[model samples]
Target chain A: MTETTGTNTRVICPKCRQELPWFALNTDTMSLCTQCGSAIRACVFPALLHTHQPDPDLPVPVAEGDASCFHHAGRKAVAACEECGRFLCALCRINRMGRNVCAACLSRQKHDGALPNLTTERILYQQIAWTLTLLPLLVFPFLAITAPIAFGYAIHAIRQPPGILPQRRWPMILAALLALAEFALGLWIIHLMLDDMA
Target chain B: MTAESPSYQPFGRSTLESSLAYRIRHRLFTGPDHLLLVRQEGYRETYRRLYFRDIQAVIVRRTVWNRIYAAWLGTFTLAILLLAAVLAVKQSPPPAALIVFLIAWIPGLGLLINAHRGPTCDTWIQSAVQSLPLKPLNRLPLANRFIAAVRQPVESAQGTLNPAALQAFATDSAAPSGRGPETSSTPATDTATIPVLPFRPYRGHAHTVLFALLLVDLAHSLFRFHSTAPVMLITGLILSIALLTSLILALSRQAGTRLPNTIQGLTWTTLVYLVLAYSFHSSLMMFRLPTWNHSSPASLLQVLYPPAGTSMITTSFLVLSALMAGLTGSMGLVQLYRRQSGHPPPPPSPP
Candidate 1:
C-alpha cells in the first residue's frame, strides 16, 4: 500500500536535475527525462539510465557531391552557390542550370529577388495581403512614394521565407506585375467615383 | 531568392512503421507535402502496430461499421448525383432544379452522418487494452497505436457530421458524442491530441464541384449584364477566395497548427454574411455605368487588375468567383477533416 512501492528509482530528471519522487507502479512511462524534461521513456519501473550517445550514425557518406545538406543530410545538393558555399536546406536551395544558390546573395541580384515563375504566384498572394493591409494612399500621409517603394520591396519578398535565400533574378518581373496591378486598381477607382457622381 | 537549386521531389515516403501501408504512400509521386505526410505517418505508425499481423482482426473490427457507414455516405453521394441528373432531364425552370437540389441534399447529408459514428463502438475495447498498465508491449508503439485508434472515430464522424450543421455542433462538439483520446490519462492536454475531429486529405474532386458551381454563376452574371468590362477582376477575385478559406484551414491543420477553434466559428459567420450581403442588394450596380464602373462593388475586383472599364457582368461574376473560391477552400479543409476522422487501421503488435 506504499505510494512509491514500485520504485527501484534513483533516476533524476535530465531537465530540472530533480529526483522524481513519483511512482511507476505497473505502468511504463515514456516521459521527458525527469531532470532535464527532454523527451524520454522509462521502460520499466527499475529501468536504469545510460550515458548519452549523441553520435548518431547518419547515412554513410558517398562523397559524390559536396556533403549533403546538414538538415536533410541524405539528399544530395549536387551544386553549391558560387558565392557562399553554405549548405542550403531544400527550400533555401534554388536550381538554376542545376546549381544550388543560397538566399542572401540571391536577394542582391534583383532588388527583391523574385524569379520569373515565382512572380505570378507571389503577386497573387501579394494582392491578398495588400488587400488585408488596406494601404489606401489617401488615408495615409506621405504614402505615395512610401507605398510604391514598399510594394517594390514586397514584390521581392512575396515568396521569401525567413531564412537563407537562393540566388535568383526575377525582380524585374515582380516589379512590373505589381506596378500593373496597382495602376489598374487605381484607374478603376477613379472611373467608379466619377461615374457615381454623374 | 534566385532559382539555383534542383527542385527536390520526394524520392518516396519513408516511415518507421513496418506493417501498415504508408497512408501517405503516394507522396513519392505527390512530392513533398511533408507536413501531411508526417501527420499520416504518426497515425500510420499507430495503425500498423495494433493490427499489423491481423488484417482479419481489422476487417472484423471494421467490416460491419465500414459497410454501414460507406453505404450511408455512398447513398448520399448517389442521391446528389441523381438529383442533378433529374434536373437536367426535367430541363424546365427554377422550381425543378431547386426541388432536385433539396431532395438530394438530404441523402448527401446523411452519408457522412452514418460514416462518422464508426469509431464510437470500438472505443471501450481499445480502452481496455490500453488500460493494462505496467507492460512493455503496452508501451511504445502500443500507446501510439491507441492514440491512432482513438482518432479513427473522429475521422468517421467527419464523414457523417453535418457540415452545414457544424455551426450547431460547435458548442457541443467539445465534449462530443464520438469517442476520442482518454483525456483523463493523457499527460499532455493539447488540442491536437484531443481527437475531436480528424483532418482529411484535400480531394481535387471537391474543387471540381465548386468550379462547376462558379461557372454556373459566371454564366448567369455575364449573360445578364450588357457590358463585359469587369471580367478579369471578377475572374481573379472569384478564383482566389473560392479556394482560400479551405486552403487556410487545411494548411494550418496540416502544419499541425493550433488556431483558436473559436476563430474558425467567427470566420464561418463572416463567410456566411459575405454571401448574404452580396445577394441582398444591387451588388452589381458598381458596373452599371461606364463612369460608375470600377469604383463600385464591381470594382472591388479591381483588386484583381481590372481594365479601365470592365463589364458589369464580368465584375459581378468575379465577386461570385471569389465567393466560390472561398467555398472550395472551405470544402477542401472539410474533406481533410473527414479523412482524418476514419477508422485508423489498428497498429501491429510490437515486433
Candidate 2:
C-alpha cells in the first residue's frame, strides 16, 4: 500500500502505483513490483520527472486600434484561420496538420474525413484484394464473379498507396496471377460443359 | 536524425489483431522527433504520434494470452481430429467428411505458428496526459527491440535519470527539482495535486469459489468416468451450471485486483480450459445423439454418460479433461493458500 507523495512526477508501476526503486527502472532486466510482485519493466526517461505545462498565449483583451477576433469580438486576434480567412483568437485557433485552422473549419474538415489526422480507421485495398482472391476458394462457384473483380482491384492497388506502412507487393501480384488462373479455369469448365451438351 | 527530416523508418513489424467487429494491423515508424503508430483497418490508416520528450515511461508486463491463444487453436484442432476419428470409426463416413480431416491441419498449423511467436505481453506508453497501449509490441521480443530502438532518441531528448538523482528525489519530497523546463506558465506549479491513496488487497471471493468448483468438477468427472449411475447425470448437470455461473462471476470480479500473478494466471487458464472442455463435450454429445433411440427410457443417461458403451477415444478425452481440471484446480488452491497465509509466491524469475 506504499505510495510516493510528490508534485514532481515519479515513475510508478503501472499495475501497482508503488514508486519503483531507481534500480528497477530503465534497466536491461525486469523487476518485480515491491507490493504486488508482478514481473514488470519500466523504461523511464527524464520526462518522468517533468510535469505537463498548460499552453500559454491565450486570447487577450483587444486594445485600441487592435485587430479583433472574428468570433470573439472583444478579444485580440492572434492568427487567421487558413481555410476560412477569418481572424481567430488564440483560443479559437486549432493547430493541426501544420495548419492554423479555426475550430469551425477543423470540425467541418473532420466531418468530411478530409483531415487524415482525425481518421481512426482505414480500409486497406491490398487486404481486400487478398480476401477476395483467397476466400472465394471455399465457395468455388463464386470464383467466376470474384476473380475478375479481384484482378482489377489488385491492379488498381499497385498504382496507389497500399497503406501508411510499407507493404509487400507480392500478395497483390500473386492475387492477380491467381485471379487470372481462376478465370481461365472457369472458362475451361464452361467450355467443357458446352462440349458435353453438344 | 534531424527534426526537419521527412523520411520515417519502420520501427517494428506490423502486428494484426482481430476482434469480432474489426481487424486492425498496427505498425510503428520512427520520425526524427516522434514515433508514429499507424493502425490500418480495411481501407484507412489512423496515425498517432508520441513525441520523444513527452514519453514518460514504456512499461511492459508479461501476459498469458499467448498460451491461451495456443490452447484455443489447439482445442479447435483437436475437435477437428476427434470428428475425423469418429468418422473413421463409422463403417460408412460421408466422403465429404474427409475434408474435415484434411482441414484440421489449418488450425494445427495455426497452433504451431502461435507457439513459434513466443510469449505475449502488454506494453503501454505513459505520458503525462494519457497512457496508450502499443498493440504492435504485444510480444516480448518485439517489445524489447522496440524499446531498444526508441531508447537512444528519447534519452537524447530528455537525458537519462541517473540513480543518484532518483535516490535524492526519493528521499525528499519538497526539494525543488532542477530537471525539465521551468517556466512561470507551468500549470503544475500552480495546481493542487491529489493525495495518493493506500492500496487495498483484493479479496478474490469469486476466484476462490471458481477454484473450489473446478476441484468439485474434477471429482465429479472422475466419479462419472468410472460409474454412470443415473444420479451422476443430475450431479453433472448441476456442476456444469454452477461452474458456468462461477466462471462468469470470477471473470467479472477479478478485474483491478491486486492478487498474486500466479493466481491471476490460473484464473485465465481455467477460463480457457472450461471453454475447451465444454466445446469438446458438446461435440461429443452431438456425435452420439444420432445413435440414440427416441423411445428408450434410458436415452438421456445413454447419451449423457453411456457407462459401458463409450468409445476409447471419448474415454481418453474425458480422462484428459479430468486431469487438466485437477491440475489447474490444485495449483490455484496452493497459490490461494500461500496468498492467504501472508506468504505469496515469489514473482517469476526474469529470463
Top TM-score model: 2
Tens-digit lDDT track for model 2 on B21-125?
Answer: 998888887877888888777677788888898888898877777766776577667767776776677744576458878889999998898788777887888
Clashing pairs in 2: A122-B41, A122-B42, A122-B43, A122-B44, A123-B42, A123-B43, A123-B44, A124-B42, A124-B43
lDDT (Cα, tens digit) per residue for candidate 1, span A45-127? 11111112344433344356456764467665444666678665454566654556766656655335344222211223333
B262-346, model 1: which lDDT tens digit per residue? 2233234334434653554334444433444355665554433434225433443444444443443354346435534542322
TM per model?
0.22, 0.67
Q: Specify the highest-lDDT model's number.
A: 2
Name the 10 consecutive residues with the lowest summed lDDT in model 1 chain B: B54-63
Q: How much lDDT does candidate 1 score?
A: 0.37
lDDT of 2 by residue, A1-198 (tens): 222223436566656666666677777877887766767788877776655556678789999999999999999998998888999988998887577889888778665545544444555677678788888888776677888988888897776533434568887789889889987876777777789999
Give candidate 2 regions above 4 Å deviation: A1-12, A16-24, A34-36, A51-123, A129-156, A161-164, A168-198, B1-12, B66-119, B167-185, B189-206, B293-299, B343-351
Best by DockQ: 2
Q: After superposition, how far is residue B82 of candidate 2 from its true place, in Å?
A: 14
